[model samples]
Target: MLSNFDIPLLLGLAVLATLGMVTMYSAGFDHGSRFVDHGRNMLLAALILFTVAQLPPQRLVQLAVPLYTVGVVLLVATALFGITKKGSTRWLNVGIVIQPSEILKIAMPLMLAWWFQKREGQLRPLDFGVAGALLLIPVGLVMKQPDLGTSLLILSGGLYVIFFAGLSWRIILPVVTLGAAGIGLIVIMGDRLCEPDVDWRVLHDYQKHRVCTLLDPTKDPLGKGFHIIQGMIAIGSGGLSGKGFMQGTQTHLEFIPERTTDFIFAAYSEEFGLAGVLTLIATFTFVLMRGLMIAAEAPSVFSRLLAGSLTLSFFTYAMVNMGMVSGILPVVGIPLPFISYGGTAMVTLGLALGMLMSIARSRRIMQT
Candidate 1:
């Protein structure tokens, strides 16, 4: 049964993993140990992906409730005694310091897919409300933990499940319109909304600063706007063909902070230029399109929801990272999928791809 797994999906993951290793090596430069760590992470991720892919989709659905319950408990634990770093209490020490929210990133989609599977062919407006509640609970908690980026990613993932579960655009359109109006209102009242002493308590200081910076980076050009400014400069300097690999002054001179992490795209662009950027984007697009095709061909509602959500979530990661670096959006710390340096993120992505492969393989078996 396991031998019937989707070769294309596996090949795609292999290609992305290879690209990640090469990019990580370039980003690490003199710190060869970082590259080694990345390799170890990729190996572990591949193992997890292969193991999980062997499980039938029904088993995945069965594990959803337990995974969600445990994830929520861990999130609560994080709130009580989680480690504080850079002014956010988002990590829990359970033999290893892990961010509980990352668990929700996977678990939320699983839980939602399970819910939709149970109510298959009978979904209604109230069902969507329940799903929304499920999504909001974790999102609200993460945002309070001051992790805006992860919270948004989780929200996007769960929403994708809801969307693919046959949500009507009639309902979606109004919500989107209202959300746009709300953002416009906030921007209109930016100064007062961000004042030191006010009753508007919807956002944290750093989060507010990010929005303000996005609105007018020139206001704090040398201080709060430094990251965006430097990132834009690096991207602009890349031109059409770029300066050449390992010859990026902005990256090599260490002018770009977080060059190997959140802002790695800027460093990559500075070195590889527009052509490289297009290639990277195209790779991500291929992965997303393939995942969607897998979702479409899934044998069950659970697999379809899960696979589709994971695909969109991957897109969200890339979009957010590029948007932040280009100064068009807030500086949310979303790493570029399969490119940016991180252990947990890579594992999460691998798990998502594995699910897609499982769905594809299951479809093939059913057709046979």
Candidate 2:
């Protein structure tokens, strides 16, 4: 129940949700019922969190493999027969609309945590190889669906589990070095590599465009670069003091696109400025720290890894969204956690936090 939830975590989430509502109200500009619907989504998400929290961590571990198995099967079905909209075939029409990749975000960590727990102290390099294979399968499917943002989320969540389970640094270091080197090379050869006629074989046309736009948004001001250019302008125009609530000129004038979704942070920044942005960051940080505390107190390896991965996954989600909006990263469809308005993303957040609460509650019970 709600009574079992950690107090500080709850308070921080409450403040963030309230702030989301305020910013959403302004973002909507009374155009539709988005503010009210967002409130409804929050309520529904809370109910899910509370219900899921009632289960013990043991129960969650038990559900892990089966949930993962089923999620992967669904992804396969989605691949064969899925709805295609906006040039991406990510959703499946199984009686209702379903995006299977979202399942892997939670399932990936659950499955990995359980896998490591089963192996326990008998760990070997082969086990890590097997784990990497497991992570890659679902991630590869999601990528084939061409949903870069969700793929990253699943990849990160699974990798976090592998990381927290004491995977060797020798393997981790090389991958990190390669990724950094790849980024540096891209920047160095951006002029030639990012040309209009050039084909970045690894990425789709739109994906390639986003990377180029990130390097220099002004190149295609009225086309692909428009979103990033406008987002930065809105953020910069806000200044330190902001334009006051409902007073963001860029937002009100419709210069900042997608003000209620992926780019909502820019609208919020335009309205509340640097001070408000700092407050949001602080609240998110508090939530992450409290989550880590719970992870540390968990009784079992499965519980600890599951909790820790979920917590850090939230950090990744927020950072990616904020980075994309700020022009530091390519624009993707990742939402800003509680601050972004989306029912599906809200449910994912609720499930993760609810499981964290369940782990924390189990620890408290054990202590007594």
Candidate 3:
């Protein structure tokens, strides 16, 4: 078990976790025991990572179907009977409350990788269609719950698996083009489309507001735009060298909202500045590259697909969180990986890295 560890990946994770704790200490010092609880969550995640690294790629493949099945069932159950908080019904009350959508973050990739592995040689367009269907079930359920952030994460995970499993750019490029065109149209027609009486039939009112607000935050600077405006202010105030640790005026003065969770990136930037943000990015890039390397050298198709998807999931999480905090993207409630104080997200990340480690371990055994 000790020998199975990927030292570089472990080191990168250690750095991120340490940063998370240090930042959380300053950011959440006044929020009761949040700093201590963040440390505890990191320990719990480490324990999970260790336990999961012991499992082989073959064992993971075996568990894929059952795990995905259970996840989908739980999503349906949540839809039927779940806890409603902040107008979203995402958590299911089993023995304890659990967000069913979080399960799909890992299970989606696992199931897709398993499917592709089984269909190794006999691939067809129908297979990809089936994969999309599988991906959309939980995604649609989560969307219905109005948890767009989790749904997008889960969707990205499944799509990565599909893309790795021989998806052609021919089928991908048109969708990308269409999405870009839609964004352009929105930018051109922002004022008219964002009017109070105007109805965007596809998106919910809140979702539409997020997009419109992202386009022009000053439309409601103190309302919907407050998060983005303050986040940008903090990031800009940090300049090139930052104000040093525990000295973030915006964070300490409570100007940066959700400083301990979704918006922690803003708080981190205010104290660490561009230089610190670059260091954080470099650390994440190192871990991401290591995960990709593990995938490239994986002993089996399933391991490769699963590892690649899981690795890219980290990319998605970091990019979305950072983008939203920087005001370049809509304010999606995505956490900044290790830097954010969320036990569920942390544990999910640990599980993902452990799977990558399992694949890395298998590759080493085969090489020997």
Which parts of model 2 have CA positions greater than 4 angstroms off? Answer: 1-3
lDDT of 3: 0.93
TM value for model 2: 0.98
Would you list the C-alpha lDDT of every candidate in the order shown?
A: 0.86, 0.91, 0.93
| Segments in model 1 whose C-alpha atoms lie over 4 Å from true places | 1-3, 186-200
**Candidate 3: regions farther than 4 A off:** none
**Deviation in Å, model 1, residue 237 alpha carbon:** 0.8
lDDT of candidate 2 vs native? 0.91
Model 2: how far is 343 from its true place, Å?
0.6
List the candidates' TM-scores in order: 0.94, 0.98, 0.99
Q: What would the per-residue lDDT of candidate 2 be over residues 209-303, giving only the tens digit for each residue? A: 88989999999999889999899999998899899999999998988888898999999999999999999999999999999999988999999
RMSD per model, one decimal: 1.9, 1.0, 0.9
Model 3: what TM-score? 0.99
Model 2: weakest 10-residue lDDT segment is: 1-10
